[model samples]
Target: MFDYLGGNFPTIDRRSKKQMKDVEMVAQLLLFLEEGVRAYSQEYLDKAFSDRDISWDAKEEVEKEFCNTVKAIKEILDLSQDINLSKTRLKNQADFYSLFGAIAELNRENEKLTITRDIGVRINNFLKLVGDTELKNQSKDSLTDYQRNALEYYEAVKFSFTDAGTRKTRIRIMKSVIRGNIN
Candidate 1:
C-alpha cells in the first residue's frame, strides 16, 4: 500500500490514465476496512456502522487518539473519543486493555479447540496404523471380534470429544498452552 500510494510502483493501468482522487481512495479504503472488520468482529462492525455516515472529523479523532498506527486503525474502527469519556453505551471502542483481554480470552478458547482437533487427527492416524499393522502381519483374523470391537469402542469414545475424558484432555492441553509447554 505504501509503495503504490507513494508512486514508487511502475505498474499502472494502461486503460485509464486517471487515478482515484484522495477522497475517493480514502472512502474505498475505509469501506474495505469495515468489510474486513465485519467478517471477524460483529461488535466492532456494529459500533463502526452505528453512526449515520461518520464525518471526516470523527475519523480524524480516531487517528489522533489511537496509538501504534496512523490512519490504518482509524479506517478499521471509527471511535468517538468524547463518547468514551462519557461512559456511554454508544462508546465506539473498548479501551486497549479491554480489547487485549478479550483477545486473550479468545486465544484460550481457540487453543482448546486446536488441541482437540489435533488429538482427533492423531486418533485417526492411530487407527489407520493399527489396521495397517494387523493387515501386514496377516493377523487381522487372530483377534476376537470383542477385541476388535473394543478397539473401535475406544476410538468412538475418544472421538466423541464431548465425553468426560476428552473434556479433561482439552483442559490439560489448554493449560499446557498457557504454560508454553505444548506437547
Candidate 2:
C-alpha cells in the first residue's frame, strides 16, 4: 500500500523516471479503483433485490444515488488539477508537499469512486438474485431466466485505502460499508 502517513505523497519533485513510474502506478491504481466501484455497486444492488424484504423503491433509491455519486466524482476528476512532473522543484519542500497532497487526494478519490461504483453493482446484483430466486421457488415464469440472465457481473475487487482524518471517522468503503445495510 502507498504510504501517506509520513506525508511522503506522490509529488513532482521526485526523479523524472521515478515520477513517471508514480504516474503509471497511479493510473493503474485508478483503473482498479474504477473497476471496484462498479463491482461493489452491483453487489449492493444484488443484496438489496435478492432479500425480498427490501422494497424495490429503496433499491431504486440506492441505484439513483450510486449513479449520481459516480457522475459527481467523474466531474470532479475531470475538473481537478493535473499532476505535472515536468515542473521540477528541487529546493521547495512546500511545493513538493503541495504536489504530493494533490496526488494523494487524486489517488484517494479514485478509491472512493471505485467504492461508490461497487455500491451500485451490489444493488444491481441483489435485484437479479431476487428475481431469479423468486421465479425458481414460486414456479412462476421469470422476467429473466437463469440461462438468460443479462446482468453483467463486473468482477472488480481491489484492496482498500486507509488514512487518518483529524477528528473525523475514516469511512473507507473497501474496508467496510459506509452506508446503511439493506435490511
Summed backbone clashes in each candidate are: 0, 28
The lowest-lDDT stretch of 10 consecutive residues in candidate 2 is: 150-159
Give the lDDT of residue 178 in candidate 2. Answer: 17
Off by over 4 Å in 1: 1-7, 14-25, 34-54, 61-183
Q: Per-residue lDDT for 59-117 in model 2, tens only?
A: 45444443444344333223422422212220122222222232234345554433344
Question: For candidate 1, what is the lDDT?
Answer: 0.32
lDDT tens per residue, model 1, 22-103 = 3232332343322321122344434554562564445653333222222222221223232221132101111211221222
Q: What are the RMSD figures for all models against the true structure? A: 18.9, 21.4
Using TM-score, give the best candidate's number.
Answer: 2
TM-score of candidate 2 versus the correct structure, residues matched by position: 0.23
**Lowest summed lDDT window (length 10), candidate 1:** 88-97
